[model samples]
Every structure is written in C-alpha cells, then in structure tokens.
Target: MHISRQQTESAERGPRARTRKLMLETATRLMQSGVTPSVSEVAEAAEVSRATAYRYFPSQAALVHAVVDEALGPILDWKADVPDARARVGDLIKTAMPRIDEFEATFKAALKLSLDQWAQRQAGTLGSEPQFTRGHRVELLRDAIAPLTGTVPNDARERLVQALSLVFGIEVLVVLKDIWGLTSERAQSVAEWAAAALVDATIREAGNGA
Candidate 1:
C-alpha cells in the first residue's frame, strides 16, 4: 500500500511541475507582447489541457501575479559592490531605472486598481488588509542607503533618504518621458542626474558651518 501511494504522489508531482512551467512560459510570452493572455489561450499555447492549467492557476490574475513575482527575481536581488558612497547610490539608481521601465505598463494598471481599493478601505468598505503599501519599499531604500553613508548625521541621512524617494519615484519617469517627451534613455539619464544631485546636496547641507 505504501509503495502504491508513493508512486501515485510522484506521478502527480511530475505533471504539476510541467503545468507550472507551461503556465509561466506562456504568460511571460504574452505579457512581453503587451497582451494579457487568457487561461484558455495559455493552456492551448502550452499544449496543456484546460483543466491542468486551471488546477495550476485558478484565475488569470493569479497567473499574472505569479509572472510578475517571477519576473522581478533579478530586480529584487539588487545588491552590487561600489567604490564609494556617491557611486554606490548612483549605481543603485542606474540598476533600478531600466528594470522599472520594463514593467511600467503592468504596474500602472495594477496600481490603479490598488488605488481604488485604498479608497474603499478608507471609506470603511473594505474588510481586509491594505491593498497598496509602499512601507516595504521605503524600508528597503533605507537599508540600501545605510551601507553607503560613512558618517552622515542623523538629520542629514533622513533628508537624503527622503530626497532619494522623491527623485526615484515613478512620477519622475512619467514626467521626463511623457511630459517632456524625452526618450527612455534620456529620462533615465535625468533620473540618475537628479539622484546624484540629491546625494551631493545632502552632503553640502550637512557640511555647511561645520
């Protein structure tokens, strides 16, 4: 009886793994082309049965969320060696800017839904956790800054971090690319410049009269 059960579990595991792979591959291909492929289409493309696809991901949103999580693997691991504080911050911004642009459309769509969810929560209509939160992003930014600053004062560190947040926001990208009509490369250049300026401005502010 034990041997039979083990064989059955192993059989199920193989199919499950294959289904997961297919779903991910299909979704990524569709999203790369600026289309949100439906579950049936994904299953057809992947040559998996519809039932198998649904078993792996019950809904399109679930598949999309999984794809986003998988796609962010490298960006989520944003740690690199640099020679100095200025270079460290600049390198970090440069590393992140292009990654952010890749998922800009997807993020813009999802964030709109999230904003609506926040409004519902504020009106006492939501009965669940917050839908949109940047607290984690803010914390990560602080962690990245901590190692770069050699001897910045507490106030200066706080000021510099706030400036980093503002300069690194998606709004900056939108303004530079959309309003100003700059190319993506040019916009990123502006963002990097702004981030560098913040670092320099904070250092000067901290040094004045000291």
Candidate 2:
C-alpha cells in the first residue's frame, strides 16, 4: 500500500517524538536500576525497533550523555536562586545530594565515557573535565569563602581563594562520593561543617586581643 506524502510526514514525526521520549525514559530506568544496558536492550525495553532508537540517538554514548545532563538540570536550576554564597555552596550540595544519589550511576557512567573519549583523543583534541567546569558550584564556593577573609595583609584574597578552592571544590565531591563511599547527604554535611568552621576560625584569629 502506497502512503501519501502528508501521511508519511506525520508518521515520521510521531515516531521521532516517541523515540526521543523512549530514549530518555530508558536511560533513566537504566540509571535507577544500575544497569549498563546496550542499545539493543534499551530499544527492547522502550518497545521500539533498534533502528528507531538509533534514528533519535545516533549512538549509545550520546543517549547516555543527554540523560546525565537531564538528571543534573534540576539541581543546577535550584542553585540559581541562592543569594548567600556560603549558604549557596552548602545548599547546592544538600539540594543535589538526594537527586545525585539516585542518579549517581548515570553520572558515573558518563564520567567513564568521557574518560574513554579523552584517552582516544589526539594531543590537541584532549578533552577537559566535564564534572568540574565553571558553574554554580565553583562560583558559589568562591563567594562563600570570600567574606571569610577579613581585611588582612597583602595576598589575603588569593589565599582565601586557594583555601576554598582546595576545600569545597568539585574534586572534593568526587572524592567524598566515589572514593570514600560517603552518601551525598553526609558528604555535603561534612563539607558545610568544615566551611563554617573555617569562617569562624578566621574571624576569631583576626579579632585576637582586639
């Protein structure tokens, strides 16, 4: 049976939309279940033909990357309204901890894929770190720690920046969560406690005998 051009276009559009939705849904399921399913498995779970899945997502890697970003979007969005730098840093982590914990497997997979890409790249084509780029996490930490340093001697600003960078940085997140196996909530709580303590100590030291 021959289909009209309009019918063909409509059919194509419906399947394309459904395929995209299926891809995202399947990826989220994989993340929740801690399953590293292949494209074929995802297609089967999504109830789409393998070719249909490939049409929406060119490759499994692309699908996985999109899913991870989607999962992190709400966490990033919540941090936008935070005005206090110190609170923002702590709040950002606290807010993300539960969501991050749930989607931890997805982000971990994405990181592994990114590392593999870096390894395959040429010298000039080397990739940068995706998890720790310029964003709310970095900016918020910088702001929160800035006021902790009072009008000290020269290079005080630089010192505070370096200290905060070392303490509440993205690398800390990876270490606390991945290496130490600390729950996201616990890690954020510890980090916030440390940041608050540093601020208090700085003020106390500056007011010594004054």
Candidate 3:
C-alpha cells in the first residue's frame, strides 16, 4: 500500500485543517457570547491541548482575526462588477447587511476588544499584544468606488468613500437598530439609501466642478 506524495500530504493536512476549523468555531461561539477569548482559553473550550492551539494561532490577535474572518464568511470576496459606483456600493451594502443579523454578536464582541486595547494603549499599560487593527472597510469602500473615476472627481473620491463608510458595517446596526429601534430590514434600506445618496452627491459635485 504505497501512497503518492500528494495523497500523503492531503492525509496530514486533513487533520490539521479540521483542528483549525474546530478552534475557529469554538472561538466564534465565545465571541458571539460577548467574550474575546485568548488562544489558551479557546483551546480549553475546544478541548484541544494548549500546545496544539498555539501551533495553530500564535497569539490572541491571530485567533481573533480568524474568528472574525469566519464570521465574515463570503464578504471578504466581494467585488465590484458594475461600472457605476452607485450600484456597486448599494449591492455591497445589501450583501453585507443580511449578514449583520447573523453575525451581530461577533461584530460587537470584536468592537469591545478593540476599545479595550485602545484604552490600554492610551493609558500606557498595554503589554506586548500586537495592536488589533481593523479597517477592512477602507479598502472595500475604495474598491466599491473604483468606478467613480468618471462620475466622481478625484479630489472628492476619497471623501465620498469616507462618507459612505460611515453608513456601512455593524455601525449601521448599532445606530439604526440599537439606537433608533429600526428593524434589520429597515436598517438595510437606510444603508442602501445613504450609499446611493452619497454617490449621487459626489456626481453632482463633480458636475459642478466641470
């Protein structure tokens, strides 16, 4: 019974992939419950040895990033398919808004951890933990508005993206749903409308300049 090299590698990778997935799922559950767990804590929860978990995630930052990525699921692969920035931005928001209901808890937990780290850094008590930087929307928004080269002036492009960013992501839910008591559907509608309005405003500003 001789196994090819590719087959041998697959057999070994199978177990490692499953173990990493289990750890991610366990960490996601803890995060959804409003706890930003460390690597060792997740290992304990997943019933894996600390050494094995460390082999997968070297630090808490790595563990949190993976958990958030899992929560994001398909969102990280979104691409703009239309030449119209307005349509692309609207589509992106609608696509992401649906996931808000499913991953709201995880998003909030991540936000809490970010705040904790920020405070620690401000007070100069932060340890060696690498900063958990989060700004995925910056790049996504830039991609979403890439088609605005003609519709939006270059000077106004970044500002438009920044304005639209304010209305994207979990912050939309935190404002419209949590504060204003809007349903998820209503919140999504608001986001889409806001995005369209920004694009329109940018176009108008460009026209005025031209």
Q: Which candidate is the best by TM-score?
A: 3
lDDT of 1 by residue, 1-210 (tens): 323323533565764666686678777777766566667888998888999898877766566666665555455566656545567677777777787678665544444445666788779986653344433246546655675466678777877788787767456667887689988789888888887888777777766834
Candidate 1's displacement at residue 11, Å, is 19
Q: Which ten residues in a row have the lowest lDDT in candidate 1?
A: 1-10
For this target, which candidate reaches the highest lDDT against the unseen true structure?
A: 3
What's the distance in Å from true for residue 169, model 2?
Answer: 9.0
Off by over 4 Å in 1: 1-67, 147-150
Q: Which wins on lDDT, candidate 2 or candidate 3?
A: 3
lDDT of each: 0.67, 0.60, 0.85
Q: Per-residue lDDT for 1-210 in model 3, tens only? A: 934334533565765888887998999999988888999999999999999999989988878877776777657768877988888998899778888668999988888888899999999988998888787788789999998776666779999888998999888899999999999999999999989999888888798985
Clashes of each: 0, 0, 0
lDDT of 2 by residue, 1-210 (tens): 944334533666663666676678887787667665556778888888888787766665657755765776566455344444456556655666666666767766665655665665645454442322223445445555454444433354345455655545345568887789887677777777876665555445555732
Q: Rank by lDDT, highest first.
A: 3, 1, 2
TM-score of 3: 0.90
Off by more than 4 A, model 2: 1-17, 35-41, 79-83, 122-174, 181-184, 194-210
Better of 1 and 2 by TM-score: 1
Question: Against the true structure, candidate 3 has what lDDT?
Answer: 0.85
